[model samples]
Target: MIDAEEKIVQMADLEIDPAQIAAYIALLAEEIEASVDKEPGVLMLHAVSVKGSPAKIRILEVYAGRAAYEAHLKTPHFLKYKLATANMVKSLDLVALDPIAMCSK
Candidate 1:
C-alpha cells in the first residue's frame, strides 16, 4: 500500500518539436516501461498529449519519495531518454504536487 502523503508526485509538461514527436514518444515509452519494471520506488508514469496538439505532452509521475525521485534521475534508462530527447524537446516544465488523496484499483 502506498502512503499518499509520502509520495512525491509531479507533472512534466513538455513541448516536443512537431517533426520529432514520433521519435520522442518512442523514447518516452521505453523509459517509462523500464522505470516501472525495474524500480520499486517508481509508482507510476503516465504520458498523454493534448486533444489536438500532439506535440504538447504531459507526464504524470509518482514516486515513493524525494529520494526515489532523485534516484530515478540517475538511472541509465532515464539518462538515455534525457540525452536522446534533448534536441527534440523545445520546452519542459516540472510541477511538484502535494496530494490530498490518491487511489487506483
Candidate 2:
C-alpha cells in the first residue's frame, strides 16, 4: 500500500543553451540514474525535451516524502550535476504538485 499524502511531486522546466544541450543531458542522465539507483526515497525522475524544441526540457520528479526530496538535493551526484550544468542551463523553473490520484505499474 502507498501513502499518497506523503508523496512529494514536482515538475522542473528548463531551457538549455542550444550549443550545450548535449552536455547538459549527459550530466542530467548521470544524476537521474544515480539518484534512482542509489536513493530509496526517489520514486521517479523522468526527463523529456519538447518535440520541436530540443532545448526546452521538462523533468517530473516524485519522492517518497519531503525528507526524501531534501536528501536528494544533498547527494553528491546531484551536486555535481548542478555544478557541471550551471553554465549550460539558460533558465529553470520548479513547480510543486498535489496529485489528486496516483497510479503506476
Candidate 3:
C-alpha cells in the first residue's frame, strides 16, 4: 500500500459519441501505454468501456505524486492526445482522489 497522503489518484469519467467510440478508445489506449512507458512517475492508467453502453467510458489513473501528475500534463504524448481527441470527447469529468488502499499482484 502506498502512503495515501503522497499518492495522487484520478478518476476520469467520459461520455463519447457512439460513432466515435472506436477512435476514442484507440487514442486513449495509445496515450495510456505511452504514459506508462515513457514516464516513470506514472504508476497506473487503466481504461474501460461500460458493458452494454458503448459510449460510456471510465478510467483509473494513479501517479506517484502531485508533481508527477503535473509533469504528465506537459508530456508530448499527452499533449498530442489532448489535441487529437478534442472533438471526439462529448463530456469529461476528472475527480481527484485520496487512496485509502490499493494492492496488485
- Specify the highest-lDDT model's number: 1
| TM-score of structure candidate 2 | 0.95
Model 1 per-residue lDDT tens digits across residues 58-104: 99999999899999999999999999999999999999988776768
Ranking, TM-score, top scorer first: 1, 2, 3
lDDT of each: 0.95, 0.93, 0.90
- Model 2 CA lDDT for position 45: 94
- Across 30-103, the per-residue lDDT of candidate 3 in tens digits comes to 99999999998899998988999978899999998889999999999999999988998899999988777687
* Winner on TM-score (1 vs 2): 1
Clashes per prediction? Answer: 0, 0, 0
Poorly placed runs, candidate 2 (over 4 Å): none
User: Pairs clashing in candidate 1?
Assistant: none
State the lDDT of candidate 2 residue by residue for 15-98, as single tens digits: 999999888898999999999999999999999999999999999999999999999999999999999999999999999998
Q: Model 2, residue 41: displacement in angstroms?
A: 0.5
True-structure RMSD for candidate 1: 1.0
Error of 3 at 48 (Å): 0.8
Better of 2 and 3 by lDDT: 2
